[model samples]
Target: SERIFENEKVTVDTIPLSHRVYTNGFLFREKPKELGLNVDAVKKYGIDISHYHNIKKGKDVLLDDGSLIPNSELTFPPQKVKSYAFCSDTAYEPGIIPFVSDADVMYHDATFLENEKHLAEKTGHSTAIEAAKIAKEAQVGQLILGHFSTRYTNTDQFLEEALTEFQNTSLARDGKVFEW
Candidate 1:
């Protein structure tokens, strides 16, 4: 299940990939589209306003000096748009794979270790191994494991377990910053 909120500024979506009662995840995405111009190249080629749109569209521009400027020289490539999936408090449900496939980053619940998978299932949560399996199946660029159960004191084991399936797996901690 999913709910989408949209307006002029942004669109937020709540995805229900969890089996626990009253649990959901969120996906935040940007909506603006802007073409960046290489000011130095534009000045060097003497490109005028008439060619701005074409340049933004990745087209070569004809300069007033009767020279041609390749789009690469006149404009910076569009910034890569990124997407993130937050899958906390969810069980090992493959149904969410399609929704988060190819996401740049995925934060999934790794509330227990493989040894305690029974407890994880009982609580509608996932184990570190299960989180890694989902990340691998989704083909996400990075997998972040969060919502750890307090039963385990050394969280490195969680990372170790998840890494066995997905090398890109990491354990989320406070003040941790992930960059694309």
Candidate 2:
């Protein structure tokens, strides 16, 4: 499930002339509920959400032992994502790997180089090296990093660091596009 924290501005809408709805938002929230939904946007775009899983609340997800979780009353089988991009800033999070693994394309936030790791962490962000680690674990075919901090005047350092862990990783610009 997408775990949206307080103060996060999450939104979902269908796009015009598409069979699948589009999702854009911060990485913290989950989008299973919105993906593939046949909404106004989808109709406008000629898209469909029939393949997307609807959201469900969990009941007794935690087990008595606390170490194991009972069946997630809440779960969405991964639909045909084709591509998945996690945006904005976030800290090193290993837990997200399962959710993003095997995605055709994955976008992760690499806000800083290694030297600024402490500052990154302090601000709830991640360094380029850390973002690559997540991409590697996720095994995504392509990884695009973005959400740069203003202080970063050059991005070569970010690319170098990310390549150390994930060879397919690259930087994202304001208006770049990738066709599946």
Candidate 3:
């Protein structure tokens, strides 16, 4: 799915202002030797995340570790960067704030309401309220909620729930442009 786009690529590091790196997971794992960069370089840029990979292991790796290996050096340009974090179907992980802090925009999957919180956790997805909580804690410029659960007939509830925590929140539409 990440490989679907090979256009307009940039780097992502632990800091909001560091020399960005390309999508290492799609680039490195597929053709590292072809690119003449070692797989280690991808790890250096905090690209090959294990949290989403090892979610079933019952380990809060992203929490204990901040996306990158400790003591690693990765510098990315702070300016001229648009960080898009597709936190697809994840539980409430507060530790991720630092890594995603100050993103120009963030798309968090809000698939349930507070009343259906149990379903959210069970499905490995976050409630609209939780998504707002993350956007607020991360201090992202804007929060876009999507991936609505099938049970939800109207998307207004998603916006309503998120607004309770983060004021700058909006429901994601099929085709839309959110200017910074």
Candidate 4:
């Protein structure tokens, strides 16, 4: 695994994937955000905009009169950190479980149906059930199946196969936006 990107907002990591050619799957984890401002509390305390940054950073607010307001009274707690994993064009590899574990959302290669295991193996792709097994083992919140081959038309079987293992599975479509 490798840390490919990092910043205040999010961090990105890459995990090696099992494929005919060398491939890397990406994991994205959003950093804990600054606490949200309590507008009512700010107004009650008569705090100015200049203090917003520090308050959101969880620092106590000190009034001009010398009284200090606790950070809890000044802002709301930060929301849960969200994580996303994208694993594509790879065979079912257990090594990726840790990197994708507990991710809020995961988009993985589900290139073939269960009946096409041979084709999937030859192509270094995963069947719907295989993808779901990985997601279930990793305990991901949601699974998105994509990178489909042209040979398949009806996707109901794919979803059906995957749903057997992971209930929170969805088929990826063009322009579909999924957020945690």
Per-candidate Cα lDDT values, in order, are: 0.84, 0.60, 0.62, 0.93
Q: List runs of model 2 lying over 4 Å from the truth.
A: 2-81
lDDT of 3 by residue, 112-138 (tens): 899999887676667899889988998
lDDT of 4: 0.93
Per-residue accuracy of model 1 over 1-180 as CA lDDT, tens digit each: 555776764566776776769777877655555568888878776677777887887788765667777787777766766778898899898988887888789999999999999998899999999999988999999999999988788999999999999999888999999888
Which ten residues in a row are the worst by lDDT in model 3?
25-34
Q: Distance (Å) between predicted and true CA of 60, model 2?
A: 42
Instruction: In angstroms, give how far residue 5 of model 3 lies from its true place.
Output: 12
The digit string of per-residue lDDT tens for model 4 on 79-154 reads 9899999999999898999999999999999999988899999989999999999999999999999998888888
TM-score of each: 0.81, 0.56, 0.57, 0.91
lDDT of 2 by residue, 1-180 (tens): 444443323332211111122333333333343222323432443323432232223222332346333223234333543445464456777766766667667677687789988887777677888888988887888888888888878877789899999998778877878766
Worst 10 residues of 4 by lDDT: 148-157
Q: Evaluated with TM-score, which candidate comes out highest?
A: 4
Best by lDDT: 4
Winner on lDDT (2 vs 3): 3
RMSD of 2: 15.3
Please state the error at residue 180 of candidate 3 in Å. Answer: 2.4
